[model samples]
Structures are given as C-alpha cells and as structure tokens.
Target: RLRAGVVMLIDLLSSVPSVVFGLWGILVVAPAITGVYTNISSALSGVPVLRTVFSGAPISGRSFFTAGLILAIMITPIITSITRETFATVPRAQKDAAYALGATNWEMIRGSVLPFSRSGIVAGVLLGFGRAIGETIAVALVIGSSPQITQRLFSSGDALSAVIANQFGESTGTYQAALIGMGVLLFVITLVISAFARAMIARAERRIGAESV
Candidate 1:
C-alpha cells in the first residue's frame, strides 16, 4: 500500500506541466543556484583548459546549467520508474540461487540483480536523455535563448527545441526551414540513441537467455 502510494505520488509529480516547471525554474531554482554558479565560474577561470570552458562575461540565473538541472529533475522519476520495473522483472530463481550460494543481500543485488538489469537501466537512461533533449518550453524558459555556442554552463545558450519554440511564430521562409531542419536533426539524434539502446537491451537479453540454456 505504501509503495503504491509512493508510486502514485511520483506519477503525479512526473505528469506536472512543463510550463509549471519552467516557472518554478525561473522563480525558484535559478535564483537559488546563482551564488554557486558564480563561485564555480570564478574558481574555474584560473585553470587554462577549465577557463575556456567556464569563461564568460558573467554568471546569470538563466543558463544551460539551469535548464539541464530542470531537465534532470523532470526525467529522474521516469528513469527511476523504468529501472524499478526492470528490477522487479528479475527471476526469483536467480535471487534464490544467489542466496543459496551464501551471497549477502548486497552481493546478490550487485552480482545478480544489477547484471540482469544493466541493459534495462541503460535503456531507461537513454529514454530520459530523449525526454531531456526534446523538452521545449521548460528549457526555453530557463536557458536564456542566445544563439551563440559557448562552453560555459553558466553562459546563455539555445537548444534546438528552444529555438523552434521561441522563434517559430516570428520565423519566415528560410528561417522556418532552418528551424525545421533543426527539428529533423534532433529527431535523427533521438532515433539513433533509442535504436542503440534497444540493440543493447536485445543483446543483453540474448546473452542472458543463452547462459540460462
């Protein structure tokens, strides 16, 4: 009952509108991280290679780091849910065999459960990555939509989805095609990632089946 309740709560939270997260990011999280972003940016400026990546005019609340943080929060429950489901599907006999072999609980999880679930976990992670990359409004709201490429996480930058979402209404002719092109690129990237993840899962399943036989 408690577990079910917890799952229900997570589902509710996960289903929240992206716009709400955007607003929350702007009003709450962005401001909260400003000090940390400033400190990190300042610290990294001293190192040569790190300076290139972290160097920018100034740290702003709205940046790639803020958008990424929000995306991570948004996708975490999805990955967690998928991983939990995968773990639940592990064979009872495998667990029993581990116990019979005098494996401790932690050892059984590490040796038996994790090995079995690794592919599923990877798939879940890839799915979460897809979700993060495709997110438009929430990321757009927080990411400070500058079109320039910069290595600094604290500097303003634009993602493909953000560009489409923010500019689609005003964009015309070649600009519209350009935005569509970006969408196509994003779609291709996601498709490739998903396909790779699926292939990994299938390979893992086949290996496990062969071992069992």
Candidate 2:
C-alpha cells in the first residue's frame, strides 16, 4: 500500500509543468540560496584546483551551479520511482539466502539486491540525466543565460537547450542553424552515453552470470 502510494505521488509530481518548476526555482529557491553560493565560493577561493572552479561572483545565484542543482531536484522523483520499482522486483529468495548465510541487512542488500538492480538503476539515472539535458524553462530561469565558457561553477551560464529555447524565436539564418546544430550535438551525445550505458549493463550482467556459475 505504501509502495503504491509512493508510486502515485511520484507520478503526480513528475507530471507537473516544467514552467512551474522554473518559476519556483527562480522566485523561491534562487533567492534562498544566493548567500550560500556566495559564501561557498568565497570559502573555496584559496583552494588549488577547486579555487578556479568555485571562484565567482555568484550573481545572486542564477548560475551554472543553481541551474544544475534545480534540474537535479526536479528529476529526482523520477529516478527514485524507477529505482524503487527496480529494487522491489528483486526476488525474495535471493534476500532470504543472504540472510540465511548470516549476512547483516545492509550486507544482504549489497550482496544480493543491488547486483540485481544495478542495470535498472543505471538506466533510471540515465533517464534522469537525459531529462535534465532537455530541460529548458527551469534552466533558463536559473542559469542567468550567460553565453560563455568558464571554470567557475557559480558563474552565470546557459546550456544548449536553454540557449535554443530562449533564442530560437528571434534567431535567423546562421544563428538559427547554430541553435539547431546544438540540438543535434545534444542528441548525438545522448546516444553515445546511452550506448556506453548499455555496454556497462552488459558487462555487469556477464560478471554476475560468471559469479553465479
């Protein structure tokens, strides 16, 4: 019953409009976290490698860091729901066998349940990452829309999707073609990542098969 309830709730949350998430991130989440981002950037200023990545104005939290954080939050429910279903599908006998061998609850989960669900979890995470990549409204609102490359994570920045969504209406000729090209690039990248994920899943399945043998 609890599991069913969780599934329903997650479904409802995932169905909410993207623009709503954008409004919330910009109006509520961004204002709340601006100071935190600033302080973190300042605190990391002296660190070697991290200093370069973390040093920035933060500019009231409309930044790469904020956009990424918001997107992660938005897609989390989808990933969690998929992962929960994957975990729930594990065989009862496998868990019992682990316990019968005197395994702790955590150990049983690690040795039995996770191995079975590993591929499913990876697929779920990939789905979430893909969703994040295509997200536009929320990202556009919180990403500050700056078009530049920088090591500073807190710097204002925009993603390919955000750029396309924000500019496609006014773009013309070469500008429009460039935006379309970005979409193509994103699609190719996603395909490559998916293929790599498939390979990883296949390798893991083979390893598990060998262990069982």
Candidate 3:
C-alpha cells in the first residue's frame, strides 16, 4: 500500500506541468532554502578554488543551485521508473545462478542484475539529462534568469533554454538570431544524447537476447 502510494505520488509529480513546478519552486521551495543558501555562500567565501565558484553579487535561494535541485527532482521519477522496470526485466535464472554460486543477496544483485541493467541505467540517466537541458519555464523561474557566467551555485546564471524563454519576446534582430542559434544548439545536443541512449538500450537488449538463447 505504501509502495503503491509512493508510485502514485511520483506519477502525479511527473505529470505536473513545468510551469506549475516553477511557480512552486519560486514561491515555496526557494524561500525555504534561503538560509541554507546563505550559509553555503558564507562558507565558500573563504575557500580558494571554491571561493571563485561561489563568488557572486549575493547569495539567493533562486539561483543556479536551486534550479539544478528542481531539475533533479523533476527527473528523479523518470530515471527511477526506468531503472526499476529494467531491473524487473532481469531473468530469474540469472539471479538463481548467482545464488547457486554462493552469492549473498547484495552480491547477487551486484554480480547479475547490475551488470545486465547498466546500459538501461545509463540510458535513463541520459534521458533525465536531456529533460533537464530542455526544461524552460521551471528553470527560468528558479534560476533568477540573469545573464552571468559565474560558477557560484548560489548565483544567478543563464541557461540556453532560460535565456531564450525569457528574452525571445523583447529581443531584436541580432539577439533573436542568437537565441535561435542557442535553441538550435540545444536541439542538436538533445538529439545526439537521445540517439546515444537509444543505442545503449539496444545494445543491452541484444546482449540480453544472446544470453537468453
């Protein structure tokens, strides 16, 4: 019952519109994390390498870190679901074989399931990555939509999707062209990543088939 409820919750979250998530992040989660963000900013202020990364105008909860956190949350269910389904598809015989070899439960999983499911895991992760890269409204809202190149996780920075979404309306000829170019780049990158993931999944399926035969 608990597992079913959790799965149902995940399904609902996955189905929510990106704009709604953005609003929730901006209104609720971002403010809630402000104190934590401030502490992190202060701690990183003195470090050498990290100081540079964390250096920015001011620490804000609605920053790169927050955007990343939101994206992670949004993608979690997708990756988790895919990985769970992939593991579920693993043959009982392989697990039995591992146990017959005196493997413990964890060892059996490590020796059999994981090896067979690695490609699916990679594919799921890549799918999540692609989703994150293309995310526009949610990322734009939480990332503060600033056009800066700071490495500070707590600093406002721009992503291609965010920039295009926020500026396309008011942008002029050159700026609009640039934004289009960015969009094209994002599309090409996503395409390549998806193709790679598909290839990995296919390879895994072929391997499984051969082993089964």
Candidate 4:
C-alpha cells in the first residue's frame, strides 16, 4: 500500500503541467533561494577557476542555478520511476546467488544489482537530460531570460529553448527565421544527445556482458 501510494505520487508529479512548475519556481523557489545564491556568489567570487564561474554579484535567485534546480525537480519523478522499474527487473536468482556466496546486502547490491541495472540507469539519466533540454516555460522563468554569456553561474542567461519560446511570438523577418533556426539547432542537438546516450547504453551493456562471461 505504501509503495503503491508512493508510485501514485510520482505519477501525479510527472503528470503535472510544466507551466505550473514554472510558476512555482518563480514565485516560491526563486525568492527562497535568493539569499543562498547571493552568499554563494559572494563566497566564490574570489576563488581560482570558480571565481570566473561565480563572478557576478547576484541580487536575486533567478539564475542558471535556479533554473537547473527546477529542471532537476521536474525530471526527478520520471527518472525515479524509470530507476525503480529497472531495479525491480533485477533477477531474483542472481540476488540469491550473491547472498549464497556470503555477500552482505550492500556488497550484493554493489556487485550484482548495480552491475545489472547500470545500463538502465544510464538510459534513464539521459532521458531526464533530454526532457530538461526541451523544457521551456519553467526554465525561462527561473533563468532570467538574458541572452548574454558570462562566466557567472548566478547571472541571468538564456538557453536556446527559452530564447525561442520567449521571443518567437514578437519576432518577425530574419529574427523569426533565426528563432526557427534555433529550434532546428535544438532538435539536432537533442538528436545527437539521444544517439550518444544509445551508444553509451550499448557500450555499458557490452562491458557488462563481458564481465558476466
């Protein structure tokens, strides 16, 4: 019953509209995290390589960090569902054999379950990344919608999807074409990432098969 309830909750979260999450991120999350963002920005402003990344002084929470956090939250349910299903598919016989070999619970999971599920986990993570890349409204709200590039993580910057979504309506002529071009670029990038993910999954499977043999 508890497991069923948990599954139901994840399903509900995954099914909730992306726009709703965007509103929540902007209204609640952005305000709440502003102080933390400011502090981090201040602390890391003088570090070596990181100083560049955290160079900007952030007055508010809307930034790459905030957008990324929201994206992670949005994708968590999907990833969790996939991971749960993947773990459930691990063979009972394999687990029993590991236990029979005097493997502790942690050791059994590390050696048997993890190896068996590694490919599935990789696929799940990549799927989450794909979802995140395509996400628009939510990311745009939290990402500050600035087009300029900077080393600062706390600075407002535009993602390809966010820029297209925000400007595509008012844009005309070459500007409109450029936004459409960005859409094409986004599609090609996603396609490449998906192909890369498939390759990675295949490589993991081959390595796992070799280890099992």
The most accurate candidate by lDDT is 3
Instruction: State model 4's lDDT.
Output: 0.84
In the predicted model 4, the residue pairs found to clash are none
lDDT of 2 by residue, 1-213 (tens): 997897788788798888898888888988888888778877987889987888785647788888988898888886898678678767788899999999999999999999888987887788788788888889999989998999888899889989998899999999999999999998888787677656755665575566556
Off by over 4 Å in 3: 55-60
How far is 20's C-alpha from truth in model 1 (Å)?
1.1
For each candidate, give its TM-score against the true structure: 0.87, 0.86, 0.93, 0.87
Q: Going through the candidates in order, what is the number of backbone clashes in each?
A: 0, 0, 0, 0
| Per-residue lDDT over 3-27 for candidate 1, one digit per residue giving the tens place of the 0 to 100 score | 8998898788788999999999988
Candidates in order have lDDT scores of 0.86, 0.83, 0.87, 0.84
Candidate 3 per-residue lDDT over residues 1-213, each given as its tens digit: 998998888888889999988999999988888887767667888888987766563445688888999999999888888888789879999999999999999999999999889999999999889899999999999999877777677788789999898899999999899999999999999999889988988888898788788
Q: What lDDT score goes with residue 193 in model 3?
A: 89
Clashing pairs in 1: none
Candidate 3, residue 7: Cα displacement in angstroms equals 2.4
Which runs of model 4 end up more than 4 angstroms from their true locations?
A: 1-5, 195-213
Off by over 4 Å in 1: 1-6, 55-60, 198-213
Inter-residue clash pairs, candidate 2? none
Per-model root-mean-square deviation over C-alphas: 2.6, 3.3, 1.7, 3.2
